[model samples]
Target: MKLAGLKSVEGAHDESAWAAAWVPETDTRPSLLLTGSLDETVRLWRPDDLELERTSTGHCLGVVWVAAHPSGVIAASSSLDSFVRVFDVDTNATIATLEAPPSEVWKLQFNPKGTTLAVAGGGSASVNLWDTSTWQLIATLQIPRPEGPKHSDKSGNKKFVLSLAWSPDGKRLACGSMDGTISIFDVARAKFLHHLEGHFMPVRSLAYSPIEPRLLFSGSDDAHIHMYDVEGKTLAGAMSGHASWVLSVDVAPDGAAVASGSSDRTVRLWDLGMRAAVQTMSSHTDQVWAVAFRPSGGSSRGGRLASVSDDKSISLYDYS
Candidate 1:
């Protein structure tokens, strides 16, 4: 698949757009794009043409993260203020307000089953789980502090959790941290199982392959993207070309390509087999924070990509 630039909406939000996700198609609407911005607003966009549909606002500080439910009717976002807002995608009605004291909130995801929401609990070194049915805290999967008396000597952000991903089977959850370590947890037991090692900089984003439950991809501030065998606990491969931090990554639904957004102000498409970037789009004037490939089998006439940037812009591309 190749990307053809479609439309770019300049100043789509007031500040840096930190996260983006494609909401799967529903019967009433085709498929919508959801984005969260440092301006403290969460927005919905009609894809292909890049038209604005709605904006949901209530966040006190920067809206740093956003995630959509598997059913496409609900989405959730988190801010630096430690609040997680789960709301209706079409009506903008608040469905749940989840909070954890002292622990800051970062990236969040609704499980593939659409039954639970997982929030990366910053500083608390844990991932919090909430039941979608009751909106009640169900479990806390804490990452054990690294073994060493000097562990506390490190900076506070070292163990600070930043992003998360749920395996397609819904049995495993992986969470990334500022220390560059990814914690793998067993959901059934709610236990920290092991860690994945590779990136030495903050691990900002990660995605589990739609086709392979064992394959996972990660983007890091180390200016590299890594492919991991999540169950094998080994690095499958590494891809590098970005001049600055790689902020986000998502694999194509077709399973042949991967897309990444970087602080270098570009979006890159990587051919998985070659393990290299084959295409770069530099339409954003500032750091591009999030990039997402639309889920396949949608009403969309063609392959689609949605990206948001620190330049306060949103760009859509036709992937063919």
Candidate 2:
């Protein structure tokens, strides 16, 4: 499988494009591409052609993360101000503005079932989960610091939670921290089971196979992508090629491949069975902060991947 560049938008944002995610296709429309940037706006784009649809502005201090709910009617974006804004996807009207003080927010995600939203807590060393329907704080899954937090632990650093992913089954949750540890939690039980240990640098991104609940992929500052058997508690394999930090990762819908964006200013298409990078796309001149595969369902057709970069551009690629 490989990626063919279909469209590239230069200066898609006034500043750096820091994050990207695909809003699943709804009955009324096809899947849409959502991009967040340092310009403090979240813009929606029509897929394939990359036409601008709408720009939602409310965030401040730059939007660092964006996530679309499974239903496609709702989305979320977070800025450096440590606030997560939940809003209507079509109207851009505020649904909820959420914050857990003393605990900053990094990345945000909606579970596959769309019942909950998970936020990576920066300083609290925990994951804040909110009930989707009520938009109320439901639980906090804490990561144990057996050795206690080091004096060097700070609010915005990777020492705290930086990224998170939900298993395909929705029964499990995993979070990555700056100290290079991935914690797997049992969602129903609200318990941390164990840590997936290997990389010593911060794990910036993570994704679980859409087809396999136990298979997990993690990207980190170590510049390598590690594959793991989450249920088996084993390091399944590792792939290395990026010269810089692996900033983001996402599994293809069919589960045959993985896509990653990196500080190397390159996007890679990895063949899962071969455990090798089959294609590398260097269209961005700066760090590629996020890469996301459009979810398959409803009116969705072929495969598409969207990537946003610090170069202030958004690139669309057709996956085949």
Best by lDDT: 2
Worst lDDT 10-window in candidate 2: 146-155
RMSD of 1: 1.6
Show the colliding residue pairs in model 1. none
lDDT of 2 by residue, 51-135 (tens): 9999999886799899999889999998887799999999999999997664488898999899999999887788999999999
Worst 10 residues of 1 by lDDT: 146-155
Candidate 2 lDDT at 198 equals 82
